[model samples]
Target: MKDKIRIGCGAGFSGDRLDPAVVLVKDGKLDYLVLECLAERTIALAQKRKLQNPAWGYDPLLERRIESLLELLLEQKVKLITNMGAANPLSAADKVIEIAKRKNLSVRVAAVVGDDVLAKLDVAALSLETKQPLSSHGKIVSANAYLGADGILEALKTNADIIITGRVADPSLFIAPMLHELGWAENDFDRMGKGTVLGHLLECAGQVTGGYYADPGKKHVPDMVNLGHPFVDVFADGSGLLGKVNGTGGVINLDTAKEQLLYEVVNPHAYYTPDVIADFTSVKLMQQAKDRVRVTGGSGTTKPDTLKVSVGYQAGYLGEGEITYAGGNAVGRAKLAGEIVRERLRHTFNEIKVDLMGLNAVHGNALHSTEPYEVRLRVAAKTPDAALAARVGEEVEALYTNGPGGGGGVRKYVHEMIGIVSCLMDRNLIKPEVIIKSI
Candidate 1:
């Protein structure tokens, strides 16, 4: 075998235009395709969907799309990797298997999981940065760890035509196969670095292809409905080139790629990942014209001493209904009324938290931990669902008191009980015990 590989990234279920993106890669004769669909909100969305109908969510959506792609890949014999499993990669695989059997495609399917750790956070543990115990605000909410490139490697080993995973690092889907086919070890820093950078470049798919680049005006965007998914050509030496599915929406020139690079990376020289800390400072970029950018010249080294953990703590609900101000100092009147409500609640309740939404400069120092502002407020607290929390919310609505300094009936203001859940995680736990089974 020549050991050559090309990778693509994007969701298979966005609009009616999903087929064009995947079929384009099949037509292009690429060796492998990687699709990523898991987002921060995806876990919750999946849970909600499952709640309504236990058999629904990202997995089925992904399975249907993969079936389409698999038929084409089988016709051309190309492998694939994806994280469309969202919160349930296994369920996604099962669905794909069923579809394959029905079609008599016999396309081998592999699933990578243990990445969706939405249920893993321990409130008693402190944050790596703040060193404070996590709040119980969202103690029972969702959390998922970002897996690295190894899962894709495992998929390739199965000789499977398609690999499905949940919440793997967006970049890993592209890099893992290249590392595996080329025989890059767990510690091959240089190659891993190249793969990591390539993954990051194409992870957002069309985003790097001028989706959010600010350069092209909205009216001038290429085929908005058929946005192109990203792809990369990795060489044996760990060097690579990035592009996308043919005839798709958006363009991937140097400017757009550079803009995507700046989207999240703070320091180019020290791009960190769960598997390795890649040195992107040595990287080079060149504008290869309207729809292409040439990325080269980057090196990698062993990973950092600490693994990054993504923690999601309990943050309470936030509700806001607008109230218009027409009178003189209407904002001031609202502020005073809010304060009175907070004071009354505090006086009536013990060990309960309360705040007046209109009177506090929440966006200022009070909420942001910066310098306090003179006016502007949003009430919230950790009090029980019924006590000060709900009471304070109701108080904000009762600001139209008929007493002194109160005349204009306060418009019904939306009251919300807010809890604090920190979604930040930085704990690294590699080398976990994997209990694999033949499905």
Candidate 2:
């Protein structure tokens, strides 16, 4: 059995930088490169696209990413894995073929499907959060379970060059290759848990490497625009050394590592997953050198009887308008403009959000300030009908000639909103399988 394997994260989310991944492939000495690009609402958004055309539910950036990285990965003899096949892995697999064929390169591609359980979902079942059923939503769009590593492993067994998955657990995508490469038994809980923590750290790609952790001057990071992605030298014992590539512009320290450790961690003791009941409390983090950390010792409880599923629904439509005002009493003028929009759309829309940008949009009037040269009044609303939502922009645009003086740079936009609901279901309800097509 191989004692060690290196896995580097190329794209963290759907819109991550592409150039940094090329650096990783060229210099990281990796066995596998992973791209985790799915978010809770990403699949729902993809489903909306698929409704318009059956062949288009996968990640929108799949083709671009493959074209950029295919030849480099092929040269390095590194395998690739991704959840870029957001809602349609099969279509994504076919798209990869088209990209590869254009470059005159042959590769094995596998699609991991069956996470979409919308057809089998019980609409009447109560939610895991609000105890409300799926019937309460305006309309159902997509429901996908967080699949485990079985399908990914099944694909790797066929010696596929790339594995595309739909709705797999964020960390599981990283864990499968470790388990497969190291010859770790599937039932080994402690090793899986340890490997999972490493995966979690790298899953967000740059987050663990000072991309999101950097605060200019306060928690300063040098050359953050060209932030480096993370890769782990994983050992067979379920431990790994975390570090970024050399000649990159990001810091990797205990602080960055610990921040990512606690991110999105609802319960430190019970970090639930489809594969195992991962316990983060047992994991140890030790900084052995600059931009390097030694990770060891994580254990897991028994696997959960139920799996958490994310259900997406057609929530409503959102319409928004923004107008900027500068010089002398800008905040006051913006506030007045906000009131005008609220009164105009309050009766028609379900919810209206009025905020003054650059002042209180993020904290919500907490740090009220009057000394400001410029302010932007943004009015937005959500409604069942797109027409009503569009009214928010129309009304805000009217402020240019209809009262608030100095209101310039008017912009308006409207888009469909997708909301997510969480639920738990029997593990047997959904089965994930690998479908392979070689070119």
Candidate 3:
């Protein structure tokens, strides 16, 4: 078994920068490269795309990413693992094979599947969020279980060059490599927890590398424009050192590591995942060097018997319109425009949100004290009927000519909104399998 393995993160989200991933593959000398690109609603949106076209459900940037890094990854012998498969892992693997063939590179790709649990889902069950029956959510678009690292571990055993998966837990992508390379037992809860800590820290790619920690003068991050992603040197005992590529424009000190550790963590004592219930209360973050942090002291209990399943359904449609106003009481004009749209749609739609962008958009009316020289009037509403939803933007666009005198830069948008809810399913109900394709 290897004493330690080096892993690097590429893209954090679906639309993350492509250049940083290229830099990591070319210079990081990573044994494994993980791209944790799937979000709760991303796969749901990809399902909609798949319904429109069979071959287009995966990540929109998958092709470009594969084309850019495939050659370098092959040259460096770096295996890739990503949830970029989104709604379609099989087709994603096929796409990777096609890219390899086009570039005259021989590579084996593994696609982890069977996360879709819609057919096995008990719709009568209550949602974990609303405590309401799943039937109340209308038409179900997708139901995917949060798979763990077992499927990925199986894929690694096959020596695949790339492993693509659908709806796996974000941290599991990073943990699987540790478990495989370090030869850590699947039931080793302490090691699993430590690996999870490393996975969670690096899962967001640049978040632990100062991308999300930047707050200008307060928490100033250097080279914000050229922020680098992170890498971890995970030891067999589960401790790791987090750092970034040298000469990259980001810091990986204790502050960034600490901030990322608590991110999205509802309870630090019992952070649940597919692999184990990691306890982050005892995680240690010590600055090892200028841009490196030594992370240790994470533990966990047995894996949960139930897995979280994200259910996506047809929520309805969202109609939105924005109009900008400048000079001479722009906030007042924006407020008046928002009020006009609200008044028109209040009776028709149950959920109408009107806001003055510069004045009361984010913090609501509580922070409405300051009036800026320019303000934007945004009116949005959710409705079941597409025609009614279209009327919301139409009314806002009409303000350019009739309601508000100085309204300019009018923008209108109407799209179907996917609603996401969560439910727990038995672990045995999910059957993850890996399919390998090669060029």
Candidate 4:
């Protein structure tokens, strides 16, 4: 077993920059490069696209990212782990193979499947909020369980160069590689907890590296425009160093790491995961250098019996339109324009959100200045019927010459919003399957 392994995070979410991965591969000489690309709703959107085209459900930029980082990844001999395969890891693996073939580079890509439980799950699955069954909502789009490091370890056993998964837990992308490289036992709860803590710290890529922590004068980051990706040099004992790329803008400090540790974490004493229950309450973050933090003291308990499932459903059709009014009497004109549109769509839409964009949109009348120079009249609605939703924008457009004057740069949008509901399920039923394919 290796004494230490260096893992770099390329992309934190679905639309993260591809340049950071390139920078890491070109300079870091890392052992593994993981890209956590899937969010809860991304799979539903991918499923929507898949319904239109059977072959396309993965991340839209998967091919572009792979092509951009292929040469560097090959030269650095860095294994890739990513959840870019949103709703379709197999198709994404095939796409990777195609890219490798086009470039005449030999690569083995693995796809971890079985997270999708839409077919097996009942419509009566209770939502986390109201405890209402999923059937009580609109049409359900997708249901996926958060898979853990099991599939990743299975895939790595096949000696794959890259691993792609659908709906795996964010931290598993990093933890799986660590397990494989360190040859750690599956039941090592303490080490697993430590590894999970490390994974959580780096899962968001830029968050712990000062990218998301910057608050202008309060936490100013140098060269914030070109913020660097983060990498961890972790040992089998669960101790590690957190730092960013050399010569890149961004700081890795105790404050940033601590802030990230508390992100999305409800109970610091018991952080639930598919694999193990990690405890970050006792973990310590110490600054090892100018842009490096040493992490230690993480512990883990037995795994949760149930896995968290994210259910995506069609909430309703959303229609929105906006028009800007400037110069003399801008706020008055904007308010009138908003009222006009609101009045027009009153009968058509079930619920509407009408606002004078700059003046009373976000905080309403709670925090605002009177007599603004310019304001935007924004009208939005949620309707059961797409036609009614489409009409909201049309009604706003009709106000051009009929109701409001000096309304410029009018924009409208109609979309079918996918909403999410969460529930827990028996972990045994949603086992992950990993398969490696050659290119």
Candidate 5:
């Protein structure tokens, strides 16, 4: 096995930019490039898309990403692993193969499947969030179990240039490479935990690289427009140095690394994943250089016997409208506009929210003291009936002539909202398979 492997994150989520990935492929000298593009709701939306069209469930940008990077991936011999497959790995693999054929490049792509556990899901299981029966969540569109590194490691054994998966844990995409490249044992909890730390740090692509850490004048990230993605050089023991592309716009200092460490972590002592219950509390981060941080000291025990399954169901529909009011008493006008909408819809819709964008959209009444010269009135409501949902925006648009004066830039939107919840499933129930397609 090699002494160390270099892995870089290309895209953090669905619709992330492609230019940063191109830079990594050309100059990052990475053995693996992971594009973690799947989120809980993202997969649910993909399922909805699949219901509409059989061939369109995967990441919408999959074709463009494959077309853009397939040539460089082949030239650089950098293997790719991504959860961009979303709801359809088989179709995603086919798309990649088609892209390779069009470009006259010979490559083998692997699609990891079997994550969908909807048929096997027990509706009697309790929801981890609401503590209610899964059956009570309404119609479940998708139920996917979080697969670990096993499926990916199996794909690596085939030497596939790209491995696409559906609903695997975010960190598993990065951790699998470490297991395969370093020849780490599957049951090696300590090593797995360390690898998980590395994976979590790099999973968000640019978060640890200063993208999410930027706060003008306070946290002050330089050249925010051209922020670069991050890469880690991981040793067999799981310790690694995290950094970004040389001369890139982002910084990888201790402060940025620490923030990412605690991100979305409910408990640092028992951070759960498909592979292991990583203990981030034990992790040590030290600035080794200008933009390099040495990470080590992560450990863990055996992984959970049950895997988390994200259940997506038809939540209802969200109707939203925004109208901007400027000049004197703009906040007052916006507030009045919101009050009108709320008064009109309050009896019809149970979940109605009205906010003044520049004043109390985020903090609500907590920051109502600020009186801005210009403010946008936003009114939203959730309802089961699409017609009723449509009325919410209609009422806001009517404010142009009916309710408030000086109200302009009316924007309205209505869409079906997917609700996500989690339940635990036995590990033995999930059987991940790898299907390889080649041009």
Candidate 6:
């Protein structure tokens, strides 16, 4: 919107650290760059880490990756927005500020909050389908309400170099600037829809460009290790550029882009958003050939009344240990051995929970309904202490005491102890209230 603004977006797992998407945006003289870090499991993992160590829960993988990207941004002087904060954006932003201060970069960091309504979570207000609060449930491991794009717009107004957010809607990241630069008001539904669609397409950088998808017709998209992220070059009227890193290892073919569009979205025409229900059917993807696609004609409709929420909690702990089998009744023996172990444990203790994962319908009824010649026993337990979780692991091998065919010949399997919690959120509470904050 600002003359010619270029934006880049990327998707990467936290286990490894490298973001080429942001790198390309900086090098290409883009105005904005965004990255997504939180996944379905990210919240639980963040909480688990917090439970272990309060100041140590959030993943620093993205922060480290930002270090490299920030260096380039500093060199080229480009601003970026990212929701890399796994659980707490304020804390995460503070840490990044410290890093910047040490290097004397003079980068301003602001965190967008008010979306997380965990303290006042009530299941009575939730819609179940929306996952917000309409009622009350006493136990909630994690509740993160999605903030809309306006807050990021407010942050950008302050002209900060970097915006670190806790949990904002994926589409909002790309839509914020369009609202800010163009002076677009709340009634600009059509432009808003276009921004939303653009955001969704670029949310998972490599996926749309054939990182995970491999078309038999295209041989260039297969080995995408150094995959680049996604970004859009936006105009004041609500259209932009869709491309990747110049030399990254991904493709942006039309087929792959369409596949990513269908990834997890329910209704393409009625794609709901807090700001507006963007209609992607109007979106025209012009295949620019290898690793490039031109997206246009995306339109929008009225904004929805509710917001989206992400809820997480402990689902109970499970431990699994498997022993090999090479006999005629290997499957039968494994089942019997599992039953014997369960009986012995229940007799010894009352509240230990056990389930046969590999041997039963745990995997899928279609995989092995009648049982196989050889199978694995996956056992688990939930109790007051780690000892109980470990006890199941210790006692399962004793099944061999029943005799070689009856229970013996039971080679010891690897032992595992698991601790799990149950997590659910009210559908009503999932909708977040968008509030813009500035430095």
- Name the regions of candidate 6 deviating beyond 4 angstroms: 1-4, 12-17, 25-28, 44-57, 126-138, 215-220, 311-315, 323-363, 367-377, 380-387, 395-439
- Scored against the true structure, residue 151 in model 2 reaches a CA lDDT of 85
Please list the Cα RMSD from the true structure of every candidate, rounded to 1 decimal place.
Answer: 6.6, 1.4, 1.2, 1.7, 1.1, 5.3
Q: Give the candidate number with the greatest lDDT.
A: 3
Give the worst 10-residue stretch by lDDT in candidate 6: 414-423
Error of 2 at 23 (Å): 1.1
Candidate 5 residue 105 C-alpha distance from true site, Å: 0.7
Q: What is the C-alpha lDDT of each candidate?
A: 0.61, 0.89, 0.92, 0.88, 0.91, 0.65
Clashing pairs in 4: none
| Local lDDT at 215 for model 6 | 47
TM-score of 4: 0.95
Error of 4 at 258 (Å): 2.8
- Alpha-carbon runs more than 4 Å astray in model 3: none
Writing each residue's lDDT as its tens digit, candidate 4 over 1-439 gives 8989999998889999888888888887799999989888999999998888989999999999999988778788999999999999999999999999999999999999999999977888788877999878889999999999999989988989899999998878888877888878889889989999999999998888887899987987888788899999999898899987789888888889988989999888888888899999889888889999999998998999999988889998888888889999898788788788778777776678988887888998887857678888888988877888888788778778966689988788999889988888899898899878896
Tens-digit per-residue lDDT, 117-207, candidate 5: 9999998889999999988978889999999989999999999999999999998998898988898889999999999999999999989
> Per-residue lDDT for 214-261 in model 3, tens only?
887788788878888999999999999998888889888888898899
- Tens digits of per-residue lDDT, candidate 6, 313-426, equal 444444433444445877666666666667767854555444344456375555665656555555555544445555676666654455236433333333222222223334
Instruction: Tell me each candidate's TM-score.
Output: 0.71, 0.97, 0.98, 0.95, 0.98, 0.77
> Stretches of candidate 4 above 4 Å error?
369-371
- Give the Cα-based TM-score of candidate 2 against the true structure: 0.97
lDDT of 3 at 306: 97
lDDT score for residue 335 of model 5:
84
Query: Model 2: clashing residue pairs?
Result: none
lDDT of 1: 0.61
Q: Residues 1-439, candidate 2: write the lDDT tens digits.
A: 7999999998889998988888999999999999999999999899888889989999988998899999999999999999999989999999999988889999999999999999988888887777889769768888899998888999999999999999999889988998898998888878888888898889999998998887777897878978899999999998989998998989888888889988999987877777777889977889989899999877776777887888998888899999999998888899999998888777787678998888988888767756568988888888878988889899999998885889999999998889898888898888888899878
